[model samples]
Target: MQTSDFLAELSQLTMGFTPVVDPIYGAEVYRFLDLSTSNTIIDSVDTSSAEAIAVYIDTYLSKTGGKVAYGGYLEKRSIYDRSLYFGTQEIQLKRNIHLGIDIWCPSGTAVLAPVKGRVHSFKDNKNHGDYGPCIVLEHTIKGDSFYTLYGHLSRASISELEIGQEFNAGETIAYLGEPEENGDYAPHLHFQIIKDLQQNEGDYPGVSSLGNLSFYKENCPDPDILLKIESKVKG
Candidate 1:
């Protein structure tokens, strides 16, 4: 497939990778994790249970000696099978392809803004398998405007956020929510960059079906363009 102009834009948009999660786990202790269906290791995981998956992630992080385990852009995952919120059992229509990069760490970990931006919207999406409390920030750097989404956030993250609330680079905007409140999944940050939100507010499609992957792939380019997490090794 051809590359997206937006994808190219995202690649060359900034000078270097910026840390959205705590810089405490920045380049040094960051590790790339594979949660896709192709990774046989995940097959042994109990993806349906948030606690079970947490154990799996914790074990991986401990063994890898990494503070953060992050990946899953456009990854075809089987974890969504337990939730009807994604779709029925039909393979082609199932929204199992993750469209964002997830940063797994302990609950209450701080989520930061990689760049200056104002709040676009914030909401509590309380579905069985949803983003839970989420925030979308509108960013304008180098005269280019787009939005960055922070999902699976703590409830307090959105309790006082205004539509135009501002956040600077590295400012604490939210915290990772617990599984009880974060769509029943392990505490993690779902970060995505979007060129267009399609009129969405705080919530957006972080997963896509096989039939609609093309459109989502263009609209939601790999966040790795800004993160460069895959290129870094644990120090």
Candidate 2:
């Protein structure tokens, strides 16, 4: 079966599941970030200060009565330009389009597994504007295998975690890291689903140029298919 077909079946199988169990079910609120819109806060973002980004997200959440800010798949963000990994002189086309759903919340928030999976790999990507501590899980549903990546997690999350360790759905796997450790950005979880790793270990490209959108889109499907948080975003 194709990746899309596999994901569609998985979505149906997990329609009512909750990806995040922290802050209690139905107790917390969520806000959606529309980076594609020029009139929105995306255009006014400083992108330099983690404090500024946190404050912007917190302010938006407060105004919208949300506890978390989420969204980003396929959305091109100038924020990625802050990292040389995306804007190096050697590369002609810059990678600004996000390939995952980032859930912005307070540091130390519990990051949970949405499905049963085994640890495929883990790493501490210490580069500025990088994923920081990351963990990739390999999962098989309906006899089809795929991988899920959790990024921007605290060191403690994987301090004792070993390769091939298994975790169940809703199991606490990691916690959000502070700005100093989470790639110098606000505390958030960069969650992505990949049909293929391209031999990449704990790290994978979370952003790509517009010219490569088609390829990345096919490889990294919308994570909301698993999280099911899109409908809960505050309008």
Candidate 3:
């Protein structure tokens, strides 16, 4: 199959990268949650508090029989209701489609950069159910420019970072933030591949409403294209 020049470059870039978590590339099983399905547990999730979110994820992990829960790219989630920041009041179409891949794991788990890149921006989006502490890295692979966004990260992740600091592949760029500091939700890293920043700084939309799904999906392709963990997902 023929691939685009951009994707071809991305493919080359990922060849030497490591798993975001050691377990995903090892013997441990990882569950893929299809939040887009009608029977998903997302309907029952109570986002009232940080502890509640932890319990919800724990129960899900147990049910799926995996230490790590992955999936969520382009998946519609009802849990976004917890935050009014998602969409404009007049839009009616709420932003529930997740634009990034989420890795649900215990707090303090290390997060690795999948490629060599320079930090473009970093900020603490301090809203309930927001990205909390986030970092966006800019990269140029074979002349094709792109960006990687690491959201819901520990405050310490960007505490010492500068705008243009560089990171090599497989380097521990950050740790999974605790719920208290990670948008008041379960500990997870929201990893996204963005084709453009649209002039946004320190943050980008990780979710889009139904009306905007096509546009967002195009700008942010499936992260698995770079993650390359399709077989690791539990059947």
Local error of candidate 3 at residue 190 (angstroms) = 0.5
The deviation in Å at residue 49 for candidate 2 is 1.0
In the order shown, what is each candidate's alpha-carbon RMSD? Answer: 2.4, 2.2, 2.8
- Could you give me the TM-score of model 1 versus the true structure? 0.93
lDDT of 3: 0.79
What RMSD does model 1 have? 2.4
Could you say which candidate leads in lDDT? 1
- lDDT by residue (106-221, candidate 1, tens digit) is 88999998777899998999999899999999976457678899999999888888999899878999999999999999999999988888999989999999999999988888
Candidate 3 lDDT, tens digit per residue, 11-91? 666643237754344425567766563745555666566677678767877986778778898886767777877865434
Clashing pairs in 3: none
My TM-score estimates for the predictions, one after another, are 0.93, 0.92, 0.89
| lDDT (Cα, tens digit) per residue for candidate 2, span 1-235 | 7766786776874655365536463524767766553536666878878898888888888888878788898886778777786775334367888999988888999988888899999999999899999999999877777899999999898899999999988899899999998899999999999988888898999988777888999999999888878654421
Worst 10 residues of 2 by lDDT: 19-28
**Lowest-sum lDDT 10-residue window in model 1:** 1-10
What residue runs in model 1 are displaced by over 4 Å at the alpha carbon?
Answer: 1-5, 141-144
Better of 1 and 2 by TM-score: 1
